[model samples]
Target: MRVEYINPFVEAAYNILREVMHGEIKRGELYLKSTSMPVLGVAAIIGLAGDVQGRVLVDMTKDTAIKVASTMLEGMEMEPLTHLNDMGKATITELANMITGQAVTKLHNLGFKFDLTPPAIFTGDNMEIADTGVEALIVPMILEHGKIEINVAIRERN
Candidate 1:
């Protein structure tokens, strides 16, 4: 894994988690996982092109996701958030899109230009959302606030 390839993600995550998620993330950490998830949660995937060729996935459980989503929507429960529902999917997808959008600008500022495909939302407990042929660098970010965790996965283009 390349540090150059990964640092931007950390930068982006910290910014988004702080600015949008109502999360006060620390310096933040990144990880790679080859294991299968018990559930897919909400996967907001933005395809990559140009300087960086990879997809970024912001995934989370329904409950944890609702908490973050509601927080983003001004600290109110969504009223009817259920497992993998459309509301949950939209919430997570938008969050991922916002992060990626900011990342694009940051990358541009740093002298790299990358284009993103539209963010896609997937909802399922047992579905797999991996780019079959791309090498992935999973960046699992953790947020703390009376016990909450938010994980993000990023993989370069296939």
Candidate 2:
């Protein structure tokens, strides 16, 4: 994917995490990944359509999900992640929404147009996200609590 297509998501994730979570967000190595890999424990998948078309999957482990949910809750303590409640699911789903919304806005400012679907939450083991023609570019952002993998895949539509 082009930097024009990818940087908005990266910058948005960094900026939102810094502003919302108030933590040191470290971006890790980036790479292209196939869609067949089983998503960790918790994930939110959002679809994109318009000038660009594809999906974004925000992925993390269960323990990480608990910490993220707590942080997003303004440090409210979260229960064990052996099972997830609505709030736990909403936390990550909203994170994906925030990240995607800001990135889409940035892309719009740069003259790209797109609409995003509501985030779809996925849990448990061995959940697989299908590839959207193009392979996903995985960007790992590490916070004090856990690591978030932003998997972005899109192709310019005719």
Candidate 3:
């Protein structure tokens, strides 16, 4: 919940997205939510435990996921995806891993130690997420493909 904890993820997301997408990336205003919030369509969630405990969500519309995945694949000289197939899902998962891995490294350098669970991808409509006692801070990143919302809901463990 501290600003210090959130900045790394925001910076990592921006850097990773810009590097992978090779396009203009803009960050939207950050906001907090204490109640359930709607999921855009596709989300990759990773759990953190140790010094901090909670989760991080990379949320985006299915369309955005597909486009982002396609862009990533194309960068590797692979065919772009037209749907969220297994490969597409894996690509998005890897993207989540990259962002969180970088952020965790930064956090570690700042003296916080934690373990991250593998990211799980969720896709559906009319979905909502509620973190019992933690308020989620969301940073929305806009790319030419679409927008990605990086939702962080971590608190220092007592």
Candidate 4:
């Protein structure tokens, strides 16, 4: 993905994390991945369409999910998230939705148009995805609680 295509997602994630979790987000160096790698534990996958065609995977560990969910739930106490609970799933999915919605708006301002599908939350140990014929740009961000990977696998629509 071009920096033009990728920056909005990065910026949106950064902004959303800070607002939702109320924590400083540290971003790592961006890298390209040729193959899909194992996700930490939970992933909220949101599909992108219109000008860009692909998916964005917000990947994080179970602990991270619980912590983020708890924060979004107004600091509700949470145990180790063993499975994808409703509140946990809703929080993560909404994070993905907010990130994509904001990014799409930014893209619109830049003369690009796009639409997003609702997010789908998936949970499992070492969960991996198959490459969708497009290389993904992995943007890793660290929060106070855990790490979140914003995997962007988008290309200009043909």
Candidate 5:
């Protein structure tokens, strides 16, 4: 992965977390392999195409997800993830969507135009994305209230 692409995502994450959850996110090493499956809690996956093609998975544990949703809903605590309701999915998906939309716009000004598909939220341990030919950039975010990770499974076309 290019240092260029990685930095943009980092900056994007910082902005998104600060705006969405009103919290600071500390980033860590990449979880590059598929062995990292059975991801915890809720996950939102958005596919990107056009100039960049790959899958972006944003995940957070159920507790943190609820905390985030609560924060988004204007300082109200949500019911636990055991409920597994639509509102939770909407909040998480919207968060992922917002992050991707901002990132795409930034990339456009840099001469890269990428199209992002609608985000889908998955629960439990069965969700997966087929492996892509190119190496994917994995970013792990640790937030005070939750986790926000972005998997940039896209590579620049030759």
Candidate 6:
């Protein structure tokens, strides 16, 4: 909800993505969603709790996921994936974790204490996410492989 909260995630996503993909990373305009919104096929979600509570979703199409995963794997000198298999899913999940971990570190330095759940990957044909009472702020990062949306929905705990 707060711009203060969103900036770190956006910065982290940009920094990590640029480093990992080893390509230009373009950030799109920020947008808000308060109602149910469709996901782009594959999503990696991380839950946050402590001073702030909610979740962050790294969302993208399956094709994009495959491309991203392949790029990441290639960087590690591992075989690139042709599809969203177990290794591909794990690669995406780790990407989400790295982004969240960096963002959380920044937030912690700013005095926001929180814990993050392990990243979870969800893939399907048609998927929608609705977070009651919390508005989600989405930052779209466009890469050579494809686009990934970093969706942040968090608020101070009562």
lDDT of 6 at 78: 97
Query: Tens digits of per-residue lDDT for model 3 on 63-89?
Result: 999999999999999999989999999
**79-150, model 4: which lDDT tens digit per residue?**
535545887798899988898789889989999888888889999886788776899998899999889999
User: How big is the positional error of residue 137 in model 1, measured in Å on the Cα after superposition?
Assistant: 1.7
The C-alpha RMSD of each candidate to the native structure, in angstroms, is 3.8, 2.3, 0.7, 2.3, 2.8, 0.7
Q: What would the per-residue lDDT of candidate 1 be over residues 130-149, giving only the tens digit for each residue? A: 44444455555666532222
Please write out the lDDT profile of model 2 over residues 1-158, one tens digit for every residue. 76797899899988888876765889998898866777888999999998878989999988888877767776554453444678878878998999989999999999999999988998988777777468898989999988989999888786
lDDT of each: 0.62, 0.85, 0.93, 0.85, 0.73, 0.93
Off by over 4 Å in 4: 75-84
Clashes of each: 3, 0, 0, 0, 0, 0
Against the correct fold, how does model 6 do in TM-score? 0.98
Report residue 92 deviation for candidate 1 (angstroms). Answer: 1.7
**Model 5 residue 100 CA deviation in Å:** 0.9
RMSD of 6: 0.7
| Alpha-carbon runs more than 4 Å astray in model 6 | none
Q: Write the per-residue lDDT of candidate 6 for residues 42-151, one digit (tens) a residue.
A: 99999999888999999999999999999999999999998899999999999999999999999899888989998999999889999999999999999887889999
* Alpha carbon deviation, residue 83, candidate 5 (Å): 3.6
Model 5 CA deviation exceeding 4 Å by range:
34-36, 75-82, 126-132
lDDT of 6: 0.93
**Cα deviation in Å at residue 76, candidate 3?**
0.5
At residue 82, candidate 3 shows an lDDT of 83
